[model samples]
Target: MKKSILTFSLAVSLLACSYAQNIVDGNKIPVAGNVKISLPQGFTTAIVAENLGKPRHLTINPDGSMYVKLARAVDSKGVLYLKDTNADGKYEVIKGFGNYGGTGIYTKNGYLYTSSNQEVFRYKLNANNEVADTEHPEKIITGLKMGRQHETKSIVIDNNDNIYVNIGAYSNSCQQEDRKPGSLGVPGCPLLDSAGGIWQFKANKLNQSYGQGTRYATGLRNVVGLDWNNTTNSLFVMQHGRDQLNTLFPDLFDAKTNAELPAECMYELKKGDNAGWPFAYYDPFQKKNMLAPEYGGDGKKAADASYINPVVAFPAHLAPNGLLFYTGSQFPEKYRNGAFIAFHGSWNRAPEKQEGFFVAFVPFKNGKPSGNWEFFANGFAGSDNITSASQAVYRPCGLAQGPDGSIYVTDDKKGTIFKISYNGK
Candidate 1:
């Protein structure tokens, strides 16, 4: 027994020595004294901003300035700010305004667009990236719908300058009462009328009304992360899949499969693209699209052809909260025109393990995924263990690429912003 114990101790010591050398050589970032993982060479991480109150989304202007949106507060509604105080490629919070809460923020032709629960609004930005016209808080669109299930109002714009907003459904899996499984859906799901899809409106028009414009897409549970792909000239959205299969329907999904089965999806969306939600979810384990328990699909079979397959599918509950296509020359040539997704990590995979607290990269060739995805960054959980949800320090919820080719990630949990830049050493 003494010999065996001594042998194990010696092996561990050697491993620790090798890990320390790797960190000293700048080959990896040490998560702890004994463990480290590789990052891109000469790429350094720095905190650009901290102590924000749930900074959800970010956008960059024609100049080097940035605009950020905050969500929910006890006293104030929310604030949108312009940050360019230092001119060092970091936001210093120069000025801010807005009394309403919103997530989606974009600037086009001097107008800054944002959304509240049931409406979309705009403000004019000046030469310094500050709100120049506060009185022109035009309510562009109003009175769509809002509820607890998918209340985040994510908005985007296309090259032609049309505006799009993802108004999400108000239930989990179309349950009779939010997340309770096997509860039959409402006869036609009244929430479908005003919610559960993307709506399009004129970007320059004011006082635009909802329920009067065209439904761009339907059957989307919630599309929080959306961006217009310039190469394909199409919009892509990353969806948050539903949860708790076996706990709600033990007759169908086994506990292990339930924990790690469904494929969080990325879709190449055009007008009228119908992604299956509530009725189905993609099962990565089975390597096929499977019907949801509420819809009567067994664990291994794909649903009917009425539902569209995802262009790319990721592991369950990664919570892909942001998507951006890299359009800069600062990084290596391999990363241009690729997609970066900010995974907010998992919460429902409890007692099994959590996943996806890091950013991932998927290279694109001719507007499609050219290869398998890779973990571009890690260590956001603050530890390797993911057994509990609250232990995570930084959950990546948003992404933005600056004009100088640096990438920024925002964490909603701690409200921190990290700027990643290549040092070109």
Candidate 2:
């Protein structure tokens, strides 16, 4: 971790222009004025739009229009429809609609789908593949539980027309008293009954409820970032690991250990797979799943193998907000089936310097990770040192690929939309 930080810092220090070539991917990514973000070689970035009011998740249409679900609504409308009238690749025309604000937005099966904190809705598309009826969207799924904590309902759709939604657990760790020191976990976490996992429903079905949907997997505390990996033909999700280990269980772990112990896990989920949360967490440093202190195990004891392991584990609390599988042909061949994850960065890595305000790449081949994760984009924090998230200039919360094989990323803080494209070098 120290080596990765040092290398990234050195790269940032050396670059002195509007763009710099990333040695990893050999792409010349852009570095806008005062904003310190960077991308790989041959690839370039442009600020396509700005000030859209905290855009969360986004989707790009075949006609080069875009829809971003805002974290907060503007003028009673939550979704922003951006149109690129010219072929210069900037979304010059922007409009807003949809009465509520939330984290999920997607386009699938000739419809544009979105979610609020508690419901999933879809709008029909016309011949242009844009939302045909913005004012009257049909409710596809209803009555989703929103506990007001970890309650972002991210949405993903598979090729089979099954739409999966993440129902985040309300409690931080299912403790008898949440976030309090020495509080034991509840025996049978009731939170998992109605929350804490992904639920699957028919994308074409309307007005589906919990009884109508299937609990595809269980024991995920909260998942903000998820996508349908077509190459693997499976659902992949990013679980936000449980927090406050040192503050809650002071004797079991120290501040440094608390900051780094449990990994933010990425699981390639199948039907009935449980990536154990609240009960256990993956220790990336130890490379094993450790039993939670609330579950009556010492910090050193490993969790039982009944729980599924993550395909990859990342540094904890970086807030993995968006996940996209690269199927676009704009980049070199090495990036074809790999994954790009945008980290919203960390706030609680305190007592140590906060990290991870950047986009990361994990190379994959034939549906499996082939190499270690590396920073494909970096420097969103605006400085090498950051003790608080509010000090960071931009937070990349969402990702989408365009029809021309370029990619777009969203910033929830400044509401900036950036497009990264290949120059075909």
Candidate 3:
């Protein structure tokens, strides 16, 4: 027992030393405004890969290799594998495969799973955790409902061999006339019957459909960012709130109120949980869930008691595209078991300056948020006040943690992979 303890101590010491060495040797990359990603005092960032394609969701293997899913196919390939041939902390070897395109990619249980808009597929990995057969991935789930709005499939897998898939609602608020001004919300929101929720399926099952799985939660407008919290044994998701509040109900909301009325919410979910998307939205100022205007709400009415509330409510219009729970040791002690979210920036907050083009950190303890959320990384928008989406330089879309506890954020605009590391203070 003493010998075993001594060996474990030595291995941890060696790993700590190696981690420090990598930080000292890694190149510091500059981002927007010539600023180096404005991290907390002790951390630094580097660009490991750049200018590939429209990289969306990302997953880092235990061996430090990365698999990135693309929003659009590059040269007919939708997935890219990146590896650092040398120990220089730069991914030099790039390979692409899988002809389909979507926003979900994950590595788990000897398989690398990816999702198209309508299906989930997995490629078995080899002994090295690399894809064994990229050309022939097993279709795990198929025939998911798809539409024009929020069609990307975001996915998360739990330790219990269950996969959670997000099926976003196509309409803004399940209106009688979609996106039409002054249109009333359809009572009982029929869209929630099949979309606007998370569905669970067997991770290894082949060719499964909607009828084969169970609805895990409902009433979310869209969930591009979600993760299974291994520490709490629960699922957490970020919901994109309904849009065009002021335009749809001008008498109830002004432009400024529209910009900040609905709060982007993070919810710790369970079976049969409802967030009241078309009927209610979180009002950060009121600190309560407000009734949505389409449901006869005049902007001041609070929601009923049946809907679940968010654990964290962020500024309205910050499109949270990715979320991750920090289980890494390289960050400070406050970060462990906390959540990291990537805000893809807003396109609709026009009369007001755009917000949330950065990464946010929410500290949690014992399955609940213990501290105030703060920004961990910023300056991805390249400008402080964004009036248009095209004016932004890079939009952060995904987050992943490396085996050595480093954090990676992927930019969907330029396909840049930014690696962030911490050097002890």
Q: Predictions ranked by TM-score, top down? A: 2, 3, 1
For each candidate, give its TM-score against the true structure.
0.88, 0.92, 0.92
- Cα lDDT, all candidates: 0.75, 0.84, 0.85
Q: Which stretches of candidate 1 lie over 4 Å from their true place?
A: 1-38, 73-77, 82-84, 87-90, 187-190
Backbone Cα, N, C clashes tallied per candidate: 0, 6, 0
Candidate 2 residues 1-425, lDDT tens each? 44443443343234311122331344434456676556666667888988889999999988778989998888988998998787775686466788898999999878999999999999998888777568899999999999859988999999989999999999999999888899999998888988999999999999999769999999899999899998889999988898988788766666666666578888999999988887898977567888999998666689989999999988778889999999999888988989999999997777777777788888999999998777787877787688999988888889999888888889999888988888855
2 or 3, greater by lDDT = 3
lDDT of 3 by residue, 1-425 (tens): 33443453344335323422211212224754554566776788888998878889999988899999998888989999999998897797467899988999998898999999999999999998788677889999999999999999999999999999999999899899998889999999987888999999999899999878999999899999999998889999999988998788776666666776588999999999999888998876668888888898876679987999899987778899999999999898999999999999997776877777788889999979998777788777776768987777889999999999999999988889999899965
Q: What is candidate 2's CA lDDT for residue 275?
A: 85
What RMSD does each model have against the real structure?
A: 7.4, 5.2, 12.0
RMSD of 1: 7.4
